[model samples]
Target: MDIKELQAERTGIFRDVYSNKIPKRVPVNLSLTLEFTAGFGNLNMAEAQWNLSLLEDAADKLCQTFYSDSCPFGGSMRYPSYYQTLQSQSFIMGSNGFIQHPEVVGMDVEDYDYLIEKPFDCIVERIIPRQY
Candidate 1:
């Protein structure tokens, strides 16, 4: 089939699901992480994160390979170096080319009562600075 035909077919599958009707087969939507996409395309994850077009190409390749009905690309790509420069220690890029979330105890055991009392204040003053 041509590109238009392929798109129409994919759209029909989504329409079926949206209209609460079962189509001939279920549509497969693939959610790809940057690390997985980079590995699939044989590209460096750190470099791919900086180059969104390269990341998009990787995502396109994955969608075609997996015959995915829909795959949103570049949604999870983050600039770790930029964040790191900003002194944001929440997310770290490991040597394995994967983004790692380090565990941080934002709230102490005694701080629970304060957090419960002032949820917004706790998030803005306590959590935001620590995490981001």
Candidate 2:
């Protein structure tokens, strides 16, 4: 079948599931990680993260190879531009190019009163600044 026909059949499977109807078979939605894609495409994980199009291409190739019902490209990996724009300090890229989230205690143990009194402020002024 053509790409369009394949895509249509894939969509129909998902639509059936969402609409609470029995599909011809169970739709397999694959959750892919950047490491897997990078390895699959023989790409450096850092380069793949920076070059989102490369990741997209790899994901498409993977879906086609595996005959996946659906594979959400970049669903598990955020664009590097987003982190750059936000000046994010929370997420760290490892030497091997894997993204890591370090544990952070954003609030003091005694900060419960502040959280109760001003939840939005706690999130915006206190928690976010401390965490990110």
Residue-level lDDT of model 1, residues 38-98, one tens digit each, is: 8888998778766767876777777777757776443574677777787767778888766
Clashes of each: 0, 0
Best by TM-score: 2
Q: For model 1, state the Cα shift of residue 63 in Å.
A: 3.5
Report lDDT (CA) for all predictions.
Answer: 0.76, 0.76
State the number of backbone clashes in model 2.
0
lDDT of 2: 0.76
Q: For each candidate, what TM-score against the reference?
A: 0.79, 0.80
Clashing residue pairs in candidate 1, if any?
none
Candidate 2 accuracy as TM-score = 0.80
TM-score, candidate number 1: 0.79
- Candidate 1 weakest lDDT stretch, 10 residues: 71-80
Stretches of candidate 2 exceeding 4 Å from the true structure: 1-5, 72-75
lDDT of 2 by residue, 7-124 (tens): 8988998899999999988888877777788778888888887776677777778766875577744345556667667766677776777777767688897778999999998789
- lDDT, residue 63, model 2: 69
